[model samples]
Target: MPIIRVTSLSEPGLEVYGSLTERQLKSFYDDLGGLFIAESPKVIKVALDAGYEPVSVLCEEKHIEGDAKDIIRRSGDIPVYIGERDLLASLTGYTLTRGVLCAMRRKPTVSIADVCRDAHRVAVINGVVDNTNIGAIFRSAAALGIDAVVVTSNSCDPLNRRSVRVSMGTVFLVPWTWSDDYQQELNALGFKTVAMALTDKSVAIDDERLKAENKLAIIMGTEGDGLPQYAIDAADYVARIPMSYNVDSLNVAAASAVAFWELRNR
Candidate 1:
């Protein structure tokens, strides 16, 4: 309802969209909770539905009555900054896709136990730092019926702007939390840890034994290095997707889709 015409890049309250680095945006209001920028009406709607509070929105003028109209309506009285496409693009360093972006407060972090509470099958996202892969994996996890997702300390933030966008906002739909000691945590929850890796003793991903497990946690590792020896060692089963045409493995995102679908509960 507070629609302001943005006339300059240095305009007050536009920092979240234009000036702040991702790290700065993350810690902008450390005590109250940090903020993240959500682009596009669709992703913003998903975050809003998930109960993330909106701080403000930056959008092109045309979108004020076009694609961004409903978002502005749903945003209540939050400040909505509108400017021409060129000015907006100059401020944000790129042309706005969908011509809208919203800065929303990050919700309080959830615990691994909370995320895994009733999950029959979960995915442990390890050190996959690529936002694109992280997002793709989350999208797959959501579609393939993975009950929840747990990310390790070193993994890319699922809420990273690019990740959130690439995920089609499925990150908001899926239950997820960060974990410092995922192996022990999953063990305590009685989950059969299945590491997606290649080892001499690794089993085929489609092995009936894996599908038979009542509760399972699939560990997906980093892009290039894959899972470390200790992580693989900690797992109850090391499994690999069968390859053909001399292909050894799939990217973490693709592999996750295969594993999630193959080992999904019946």
Candidate 2:
């Protein structure tokens, strides 16, 4: 087992802890096949149970024999770095709430067509950047029967630690694909492209088109400014969830839940 020392802020092993920027961490992880940092012993254990590989683990010395032990056992001879509380803080550059973190390799990506091949309904994420919302959306998607999730290139990284934690690792379970350009491909796949937007010609969310279609892709947008006009124009149907007056909308995450529940098996 590799014993990593938390001696400096710049050490590579410690860099993986928390000191790196989100993008730097994502890049390093992508090179390692999109691995993710699973914070908290609970999250780590869940990922492992789901068949994710543990590259290494860092934990407070106290948890080495307690919270960290089972993870080590399941990980099979992987390095387990034990550090004093202050040392652990120095290594991660922040105080860890759960006192344990496991770095696990990401699951492989599937093509949109592959994910949607057998799916009757799917959720298309345009540019939702809030990690929490992304996580919440994944949970709703899984619970409400979105067959797959199609994400945009410009969206927040789904593998972000907060997102993964918020999702309870559902991000790994769902089949998703990143698409810089999905318009033509979705059109070719026979999915009725539906945009969630409020516009002059936008249809109500309860419109029969959503329920009648066999293959549907519900497109949601970022929090502010809503869906871009281009995306709205690209959609075959623009839909909005009817709401009470003076309440114009819902948070993207809540909106996703509402949409997914209604669209599921509709």
Candidate 3:
């Protein structure tokens, strides 16, 4: 209910929305889980519904009743910063898609074991640093019946602002965590690992043995170079999505969708 107008770019309590870089925000609290921005009313509502804690909200004054009304009401006593579109854009360095952004506190990341506890189908990203592609893959994983996502520590953060926005907020819909030894951990849990690569030993995605496994971990690699030799070696099965016209490969995000659907557990 404390609706404060943002009259200056340097106004107190506004840094989280503008001044801090994603890295800075992520390190804002160390292990306590850093902060992230959820843009637009719909995405903000989704994050809130997922039990993410709202730190504060920044919205255009025009949305006071028009678009952000319900979000504001649901956010309860958090400090709400209102400003004109022009002034607000100057503070954040870009126009918000739906005239609102909320800063939310990140929850502690769980272990890979906890993530795959009851999962039959899981998607794992290794060294994929593209925020947009990472977001798109998460969207596909959530919608295509993949039960969980596990990202290697070298992969891009799913909670990055651009990733969160591009995902249409579905990033919060699927359970995910960061891991360094994903292959080892997953193997121990009885998951058959499938590395989407083009090695000589690679099997087609529809290989019957793949779909027969009750627990699977489909691993994707970086954009420039597909999976590393070591990752492919570590995998229980090296597989490739069938391509035509000698195309040889799909973008990691596109490949992920094809893999998730074809390898999905019935």
Candidate 4:
């Protein structure tokens, strides 16, 4: 094991776990060559099962003899760095949950076309900035059989630590891509773009149009404002989820699941 002990919070070796903000962590941990911090043993184990390589692990010293020991035994030759609870807390800037964290290398990213080429249905993002929503959408996308996810450069970082954790690490399981010219690419691909909107021209969520086509892309917008006019105008189809008497719409995350469930082939 290449384990190194850190008696002080400022130890240089701790930078891998200490210095970066969640956004920086996402970029760093991406397949482009950086690492991700997986909190909680179960989530870390999930990442490992998905073939992520662990650089090292930090855990409360007390856990070393208990739960941590068993987890490490299965980690093969990976080093386990042990520290007192106070020291681990200071190093990570938060109370350690499950008393374990694993730093793993990011896997390669899949291209938008690669993710979509085999997919019959996909979810496209315009500018949903909330990390939690981004995470939830991925989780729902995976569960509802959405083929892929494409995010504009301006969207929330999908690999954000909070987003990864919120998604139960599903981000690693789903294939996603980024688009600089999001609309043009979809247009050229023969996709029937369906923008989720509440406008009168919008069709019902269960409209036959959503199911009629094999290649479909559902464009979702941020919370405060729905799809921008350009995104709406670019849609090959516009649709809205049905709601009760006084309700206008569901939260984006909730609405996404409903839409995906309705549109996904049975």
RMSD of each: 0.9, 2.0, 0.9, 2.3
Tens digits of per-residue lDDT for model 1 on 1-266? Answer: 88899998888999889889888888899997799888899999998898989889898888888888888888799999999989999999988878999999998888888888899999999899999999999999999999999998798888889999999999999999998699999889999999999999999998999999999999999999999899999899999999999998899999999999999989
Candidate 4 has its poorest 10 consecutive residues by lDDT at: 22-31
Is candidate 1 or 2 superior in TM-score? Answer: 1
**Model 4 CA lDDT for position 235:** 85
Q: Which of 1 and 4 is the better model by TM-score?
A: 1
lDDT of 1 at 59: 88
lDDT of 4 at 230: 86
Clashing pairs in 2: none
The parts of candidate 4 lying over 4 Å away from their true place are 26-32, 69-71, 74-78
**Predictions in order: lDDT:** 0.92, 0.82, 0.92, 0.81
Query: Each prediction's TM-score against the native?
Result: 0.98, 0.91, 0.98, 0.89
lDDT string, candidate 4, 116-199, tens digits: 777778899779999899989999998999888999888887766677778888877777888856677766677788999989
User: Compared to the true structure, candidate 3 yields what TM-score?
Assistant: 0.98
With a 3 Å backbone cut-off (N, CA, C), the pairs that clash in candidate 3 are none
Encode model 3's per-residue lDDT on 101-204: one tens digit a residue.
Answer: 99999999789889898999999999999999999999999889999999987889999999998889999999999887998898888899999999899999
For candidate 2, the C-alpha RMSD (Å) to the true structure equals: 2.0
